[model samples]
Target: RPGKEPEVDLPYYHPRAPSAEVEMTAYVLLAALKTEPAPSQEELSFSSLIAKWISSQQNPNGGFSSTQDTVVALQALSQYGAVTYAKSGAASKVTLRSGGEFQQDFQVDATNRLLLQRVPLPQVPGEYSTEVSGEGCVYLQTSLRYNVQPMQEDAPFTLHVSTIPETCADSKAHKVFDIGINVSYTGERNGSNMVIVDVKMLSGFIPLKSSVRKLERHPIIERTELSTNHVLVYLEK
Candidate 1:
């Protein structure tokens, strides 16, 4: 099969950091906003939320991952701001609350609107709420950072890697050995997206070019790449 785009089904904005997916999503939202019929309040609300989220991904240098993403994100954010801007001017306050345990306030005013202010989240694995009052367009965004360890109990996928020729019974085995890889998906879904396997060669060893070409021709593999210190195998789902 040929290469294709991935499908993101998670409940979060994205599974990883800012990338082309985020840029495309922002463009899609902008397209939705420009449709013939006016969007419902619910859709507008959702779009606003997405716009703020994209804004939060902005780099300190005032750009996204690339120039294209930066342009689209800025266009979407500007449009959202125009649509939701309040006529009256007043200082706005954002409140971050986690259940009944913690509460913090962030004030946004003309004096501090251009400045960047941030506070660390007090807890992890907690439900938090953001509310804004006396607003003239106060954007509040929460970022989530967490580690993803291998799933021990109910992993969606499993990988096994081994090398042939346990012993140097054959002289050539010392110089070149075939690598064996077995992967299985046991998740609820039919399968996963594309998987990339990076096999790093030993300091003095490298993959054989002919071997890489053979792997690249396999039906299950999309492409193969050989570098100075590693071999990359692209596998299809």
Candidate 2:
């Protein structure tokens, strides 16, 4: 009796699977780029392709998805200029404005500890915020709003964010610093559904690395594989 307790049936629950829309969209974009001809070899533009795709996905309120789809879309669009595509009757310009520039100053103390003076960035519509500070560590915060629906201002939510540093290699410097923000969602039922449409910031650093090694190795394609009819057979069979 002490070793064997009554077997009780617990509720079966499954967490939602990861979204594949982002990956699928990216694959489609790449395929489109490969099949579509460019106006000129010098004029090849991935941005235009991405912009077109993003435009189709944009919600009526100007916000994108909070899922990976949104992340890939934003990253691809960011690679291009402010605009991605132009239609006949639509606005001739598509400007992607996150907000004002992020500013930071660096200083060194007598103890050689690096000091960072980060200027507070103002909040923007459809944004989020996060902050962190500690010894040799930093934190990140962000907010994003759902463009598909209007949310109450007092609702609780979260955002997707990542931090990266700008490189100083061209300047002969060994390091650089930067951060990033994106949209995400987090809330409990009956709590809040509002997405924070405003600016959010995260803090971190770039530790200098002396020796760089490739994290991934490229596979070698043999000459025989390229020259033989066996290539097709090998690929298919």
Model 1 is weakest, by summed lDDT over 10 consecutive residues, at 1-10
lDDT (Cα, tens digit) per residue for candidate 2, span 1-237: 024333533332222122355446655554444443443433335535555555555553444656666666555554433232323232111122233544333332324332323333465442423332323222121223333444557434445645453455555333443334444334456543322233222223322222111111213211112111111111110
Q: Identify the candidate with maximal lDDT.
A: 1
Model 1, 159-212: lDDT tens digits are 898878766699998899887878888899988899898889866788888888
lDDT of 1: 0.76
Question: Candidate 2 lDDT (Cα, whole model)?
Answer: 0.37
Using all chains and alpha carbons, the TM-scores for the candidates as numbered come to 0.41, 0.21
